[model samples]
Target chain A: MAVKDTRAEDEQLNRFWYRYKKHTLSRSIVLQLMVCAVTIGIILTLYPQPTIDAWIVIGLVTAIAIVSTIVATSIAMRPVKDLSSALVHISGEPTDLTPPNINDSYYSRNKLRPLLKQIYAIASANITDAEAPKSSIALPNISGQLNHTSTGIVMMNQSKQIIFANSAAPISIDSNGVRSLDLIFDVDQPIMEWLSERGEHDIHAEKSWRRIPNKLAGESERRIFDIHVSYDRGSEAETIITMLDRTGEYQPEDDDLDFIAFAAHELRGPITVIRGYLDTLNDELIGVYDGDQEELFQRLIISANRLSGYVNNILNASRFDRRHLKIHLAEQQLADIYDVIADDMRMRAEAQQRLLSVSFPPNLPTIAADSNSMSEVLGNLIDNAIKYSNDGGSIEVSATVNGDFVEVAVTDYGIGMPPNVIANLFHKFYRSHRSRETVAGTGIGLYITKAIVESTGGKISVKSVEGHGSTFTVSLPIYATVADKLTKEQANNTSLIQHSSSGWIKNHGAFRG
Target chain B: MPIKNILIVEDDRFIGEMYVRSLNKAGYSVDWMVDGNDGLIAARNKPYDLMLLDVMLPERRGGEILQILRGGAQDLIPGTKVVVLTNFDQTEQARKDMEQYADGYLIKAEITPKKLLAFIEKLAASS
Candidate 1:
């Protein structure tokens, strides 16, 4: 019975709409004809003795009158047309109806006020039906799950004001009772930047930040969070940021370390092939090139060498981070190690228009260190000197004996660091803000250099004056001093002596000396 | 004996060709294999003076081949020297295991053609 009543009401509405449109159209046509006649009558009055030009003027005025009347009629009938379409749309999809305000004066004085009232009644009923299930079932369930989830979620407006924050969000309300994203995240976090940069286009971005909050409930631990930011572009623009705590869940061995090692290993193969080809080319093409061509070939070899060094640095840095890097300290001739790398260093320095000079005192003692690691340390220091120095500035590598340690210093007359920059120089991924733009570096070179130096019971320090120059000094324990200490600690420790005789140990006499 | 005959087992064709060209230029007979299976077959078939084996290979790993050749009841070719040349940085245990069966282990990235020739010449002179 209800369905039949609805169908009858719809049919009546359609009939009323059709009749209203016909009445409006006929009225518009009559109004336009009257306007045209009046305009022609005025034109005729202005020119009683009508000539061909006067008749033409009357015809143009009549045409303009007809057009203006049609436009005005359409403008006046727009509200009634809207009402008819609103009714049709509501009948088709009642749930999407937006009821008109009955209290508005326009609707009150409208010719289709009854139709508007009918649509309003149907709209209210359908809206109630649509909202009932959502309020009863989905709202509570969503809020409950959001409150229980470990991951913190926050939604913000374009101004970065927190619109909605879940229970897991580490938020604090200010005295004004306003909760903001600033209270939950640090100022350095990229989430705030992302929110501020929100545009009409959608954005999806993620970053990781390490945070250490104050003790809460007697528990204080370092937490690493991977923050995900998503922006939705629409009339109601919003940004959603989610923070997933990855402190306990992060497994370096299973994830990024292995990937770094794998990638570095794979990269080494190609570098080897490239270097091999370059070497063969150098051998076969020796003495066949002019000065400029030879310089270019030399630069090519230097770049290949640098690439190989970067791969090694990445692998070693990953290994050092995991404490898997093994440094077998033995008596190593510092001269031999330096000699192996000096030619490459010289080429690198010359390529950049810098002079490199190596000076070592004769009869220098061997140092107790890993030859490969020592080479890396010296290479990193020299590479830094070459990179940081200005063109034509000379870089000097020299050694000095200081007590029981042999200090190898790499000095460059170029841009240097201030005390503040030097303070965090050894920290991993800490590149000085001043040099970050002008200099190209991975920021892990010094970190790995420091670790390797310390692992071998050596020390690395730097002295610099901003805009003048810098000097990096690495002091390694003399081989005899370290060996003596080891022998005193363990008289039967033959392994140290035995290990020192392996390859690259050119000075066996240093053990007895 | 001087290293007159050499076998190179490398997957990368460019690197293999480089080794072959350099070694052949230096008047050493060379056999290049692109995979571990062919390499092992060739090694078992004939006794080359020196075998340049790569660690990461298809069909069989350099470590497995080394174990099969050296861990057998009797040596396949008693005096043939095997040098493990690779770019892979093995773990401590894995390296130790491979080092047990190989005469020498070298990083490929650290050794150029000239350096490898020098190393081979030194190995030949020592033997």
Candidate 2:
């Protein structure tokens, strides 16, 4: 029975040597061949002489062969132990890496003893560290490189070690080091389970996460992240954890409940006044025969129209919020639109005893824009200027073409905006805190104007002082083409030709045309 | 001057019909045109003692028609006493900026039909 057991053991050892020989030590194969060659030479050099010295030399050759064979076997098996312990280190599992009968084997005193000792030491060191907090793991240094650069690697493992983090990660994680993955995201069930499970998770499926705290510009806020889980292919128990920061600025959704409430509030007063006027007009309490009564009806109509303008502005602002505002691009003469708006507002300006003036550099290029929108924009600006101007102040509308861009400025010499109000003037429903007492405004005109201008790929900026006036400058790309000018000229010629033909017909007695 | 006939030019059908109904009850012959173009055609085709003109018309806006008349585009409608009706009273100040255009300016929203009838009667008596 002992002989059969020894045979089975010998078979296992032979298989193990063949398997790990290439991975562990193919270099020892050449060493064994050289040792065998020297042994054979020593045996051949000693003839079959019946002498004590010859016998002694033969004994030395046999001992050398045995020692060389033992050295080769130990060299081949050392790395297998190391590989097994590495797997155990990653999994947090106790590994049985001791070679059977290794201490009783002939190669126990070989150089491979030290390698086996190191692998055992490494595996045993992790036994007590099983419950070590992941946060205490060695963290990488990642500071001062956030805004301009990003490292593309992300890592998480079952060994509780993570690596290759950029500057934003430490700040994002909100801890000194990684905590238990479960504890970090325990609020999100799917994410916690996904991190524990050693497998890749689809970001769409595992998107829920615990909110991480962040401070931006002295304000505290929360950041969200999407964790992607992956496992090391070489070992099933090992895992990789990666976090992606999905945080961005807050853009309020249109149709937000608060925004709708704001809209309703804005329209309520104007609509009430309009409805009241209509009721009075229907009642006709003023008798039919007075000349002054005719004038009163006219004033009612004017007020109704003014109220209509406010409603239209609110609707436009809502459209802007929805991102549904579309620009109708057309080749339009900027100077002509400016002239019409300035001319339209001139009377109102004068009514307040304020001055309104417009100037255009001669032969300024025509801009491609929606004519109605341009007129509306200019009209609102000029009207606001007139409304906000002091009794004796002036409002100037000026435009000039400069290097492929046209800059139009509306300057009002009136009570201007403070820095805080000016900063938020383009925000929806933001009324100038200063102008609230002095002016009657819906606070939507400038917001709508900015939206319209930006929708056309133009930019608007303002400069203002508290007690002086504000200057709003709009810079639009000039889109003047030779073809457009030619077409315009052709249109003018056609109209002129038509006029001359009509004149000729009238003079030539063609039915008195 | 007998106040038997009156011409009304208004773009809005509802307002024009209202004017016609109100003027006919006041014992004046009323003819209504829906726009400036038709008004010009009707004015040349007949002699009316008074013409009520709306300054903002749908087709061929009232300002264009006025420009044609004041610039000698038509002779038969010459010196027609025109009373301008507009939704925007500020437009009176605007119309004044135009030379030799509207004879008089009236706001539609502020006036009642009865009041408009009296004003027309007075103008007719003066003429």
Candidate 3:
């Protein structure tokens, strides 16, 4: 529904029909005209009728000719309709999206089949060629210019054969000129596994490095190098992969991150213990809570959940800093995600005397995302909205289709931020100087949220005015997969922390404390 | 089937106790060991329905224990289900080792007592 009708599609379809028709002229109309002449000639030769009778026969034949022309025109253009439908499936999706097979009729098998292939090839090429002008990025100095710097430059063809490799490169081939990265880099994890994941990425886009212990480095230490990729995806041309040694960049941070990760997990132990005992105490085995004790229990539950959230944020921050944040992307339901985040935060919002609401079009498309990461993304946004807003200030979370993306917006009319604060809201550990004193936060929430949104091929931005409100919006590419239910357990969430999607489990027996 | 008995190998008393209580509440016989050697001894002596093994232990890492149970000549508790509990040290070697031997790898900070019980129950049922 986000894709409104466009003149470009109509024009392209018309162009396709023009190329499909064999002759320049309207063949169907010409054939109908020929048939009319033939019928008239036969009538005249068979019956030399008087003027009135001849006129009646001629008029009837003329009408028949018109009807025949209409029918023939439709049949001729039927292939056009079929081809247009095929292109529709191809237009908005990747080249691998399987277009409908052309019907195996005589007209289709020969005519439409060849045309469909040609059109598909053209469309896919056009998508890549749109980037061809941008692919003019000068290959980072391949020879003498790059040799001076420690950065390793390696250009590889579609088969991943090394076309060029500097001596200083992080990876190298043998005397036999072996091309596979597996053969060259003595790494615990395959370097090609990292390289092969980003073939369709647009020009100049860089994927994160796969930090693995390099046996080749001779130190048994983890070697880090980003794989800068440049390739014309439509062609079998070489993908230029440049390895910039970032091991030095994050080497020192590792010690701090290790401590941070362990400290966060250590904190998580107490929180979990506290929460577990609370849940057990509230269970049927323990005496039911009195009227006032019920509210007290709720407050305890909220605080425990908050502590867990803070610890998880620290863990996420360290994971991100250490480049251990693994986002497993799949098609995910936005509606389900919105529902889960809202439901989990509802009690917390009520505790703070604020309203939390979620409204999305019932038919919002599934987005290409990491489900758990996306939950974190939305949760962080809503959390900030609730945290910054004044008591009783309503928070609204809504999503709408925007072009090829689903635009999710979280609006809150709380204590709004100034221009300066809004600018640095996503900076690592960037708490507003004012909020730093008043609010309790790890300050890594927005940073992690932004990283997640961007890595999933989405964008996050916020607009706010001081003392009014803020609207944080995230735009995610719509995935074509079906909606899936939010289960409490996930393959990725096989960890010590409860996944945000699992917050709904609180409603299950003895789940909520 | 009768109650499934579980053995938990963890160093932290708080987390170990939490898992123990939660698993007990779920109607399973649970045992906890704070040291790697003692846990391994218990694992080899008794046929547990499932084992929640932590990677960082006193004498031996959980990965080593799993490797012994899975590949050693003794093949102690070969049929027992083992899920590795990881902490901050998710180095490539540690990750690959766990993946090589353990049935599942979960982070201690990412999982809770209730969630662990759910996973234990799932493994118990499947076995």
Candidate 4:
């Protein structure tokens, strides 16, 4: 978008110059002719009578008037003429808009000086805006910081030329400011290309850390620099591209996720086999168990199964805490998810003597979500509602079509939380004072839920009123790949519950406490 | 039709034996290979119904082996449904690469033999 805006501005500047040039030439001719006509009329009025000698006097007067008019027009137009030539100079080498050598004449100093300065300011401002939208990032006194700091600092103009270079900048990149920074820094490869292509730079939006390989003096040893790029739209530095050497500290080879995964994978194999064998025993596929033995084995198997769930949650929570959870996104129809989850949740709600109400508006947009994560998120919220709610309290799960987002809210009319408790609900290992005593929880569910929600480019929020139930809303972005053309007719029916796949749509079942 | 056969490519002997026993009990003809190289060779030779590949192996990494199986580095068993099994905390890089080719992904310690059998049975029934 920025690049296209720049090209448009450049074309506009060029067209303005073309029109200005033609208008000046035509205006000059008209002015000269007017001057000659007025001078000739003045001579005729002064003579009053016509004779051969008088006619000669008139001819001389007209000749003198034409000569003086031509000279005066040239003199007056000279400054504008110089300015046009200067504009052409500035346009050709626009990236570096420094006014160069010019003829010092009577009109050059006073007229052209301020005008040239004003035009330069406007062109620079336009180009900077083209580089990046007026950045909301607050950058402090960069020049002062650069002088005191040891790290290399180089600020680039719109064309990627080093406009301001501290002494440390050249030493770090091992290149003088004589060449385009691309030769020394590798922003043109991945960082700049991704920004131009995708309009973002961060690996994640929270941190602006990007690794750009620094081309050392020789290709023998590879050196890397971790840089955080910030665009300063207003200040002298149009784009502050800060480089910090990360060759010593950042090592991809030493990442420990593989090791942890390996250990976890190793632990699962034994656990799976043991659980399978236990299931077989419990099923009586083995020799028939005696009454007392069967009871003991059942108890053992139940505990083991519960242990497995705990282990899985703990392992998953470790990743979520570190923000290392991996999720695969696809365009998934919400109807399929609702049908699957609601079927099981209905049974659970009925067992607890509570009512579970589910409603889905028709033509619901598909969300860009990992089905597994979606299942886990929905499962967590529903399970929490079931556990936290009082007996016979109703739980409502509804899917509403929000603009550019699909909101799946689970509102339970159970034991609602106070504001102080609700504030710490999403924090890891934060158990409410009321729920901690009554409910059994690890407090990792909401933390994992929040992480999964954010990674999908969405948000999860909660609203609660003390003595009433709490509402937990998970908002997911509509998958861009899917064609979800919401029609005017569909928009009229805010509750299109009767329209979507009816397997789980608008199901209302109440159970007696 | 012939029996549903599967190749279990895992380095851990304990895990390899456990999967073999469960797969056998589930009525699958299972071939267990302890090394990634041997697993790759076995997969190339036979049309196994499914392949359980572990990331870390003695001869080759599980990712590299899957790459060849999926026609990335080399195409060996393009039609074979592979399950990339790893134990560590999830990594975005591995999942993004392996999930493209694999039929399923599992963390072994987190999944029991019955769950593994359930996956195999589902894959077998679908195929």
Q: In DockQ terms, which candidate is top? A: 1
Docking quality level of the chain pair in candidate 1: acceptable
Estimate the TM-score of every prediction: 0.59, 0.37, 0.54, 0.47
In model 2, which regions exceed 4 Å deviation? Answer: A1-305, A481-513, B1-127
lDDT score, candidate 4: 0.62
Whose lDDT is higher: candidate 1's or candidate 2's?
A: 1
| lDDT score for residue B74 of model 3 | 66
Identify the superior model by DockQ, candidate 1 or candidate 4: 1
Q: After superposition, how far is residue A2 of candidate 3 from its true place, in Å?
A: 69
By TM-score, the best candidate is 1
| lDDT tens readout by residue for model 1, A1-513 | 999777756644345555677787788778878877886777678768788987787688767777777787777876766686676565553333344555667766765677777776765565564333223333333455477566777766656678667876667789999985432232133466655565545444444443312122113443445566666543122566677765465433224545766688888878988988998898789889986999899999999989988887888877775567767676677887786677788889889999998999988998888777778789999999988889999999999999999999999999998998887787656688777888888777888898889888888899999999999999999999888776564444334222221121111221110
Rate residue A479 of model 4 by lDDT: 78
* lDDT tens readout by residue for model 3, B1-118: 2338889999988878878877887888888999989988999989987788987789988877877787666657766777777555567676656655666556565466666666
What would the per-residue lDDT of candidate 4 be over residues A1-513, giving only the tens digit for each residue? 999777757654345545665676567667767876787688678866778987787678767766776677666765665566566554553433234343445436555666766655655665565455364221332344356444556676655556676644533343453643432321123445533443334322211444444443224344456666666434445556666766565333213333443365456656766665676556544467765776567556655544554455555555653445555455567766565345446656766677888887888877876665666678678878988898889999888877889999999988888988876677555688888788998776787688778776778999988878889999988876333433332344322222111010111110000
TM-score of chain A of 3: 0.47
**C-alpha lDDT values of all predictions:** 0.73, 0.56, 0.66, 0.62
In the range A1-513, model 2's lDDT, one tens digit per residue, is 999777755633234434566544555655766776786676667754447876686677766766766676775565564454444444343434434233545436554455556655654555433323133222321122222232222444445455344443433343676543322321123534554553454222223232322222123343434555554433322343344554452223223423643564445344433533454454565566376666555555545545554654665566554344545444456875564344336645665688888888888886755554666677777777777778889889898777777899999988887787776677545577666776888667887888788766677889999779889888776766433653575453221111110011111111001
Consecutive 10-residue window with the lowest summed lDDT within model 3 chain A: A504-513
> What does the lDDT read for residue B83 in candidate 1?
79
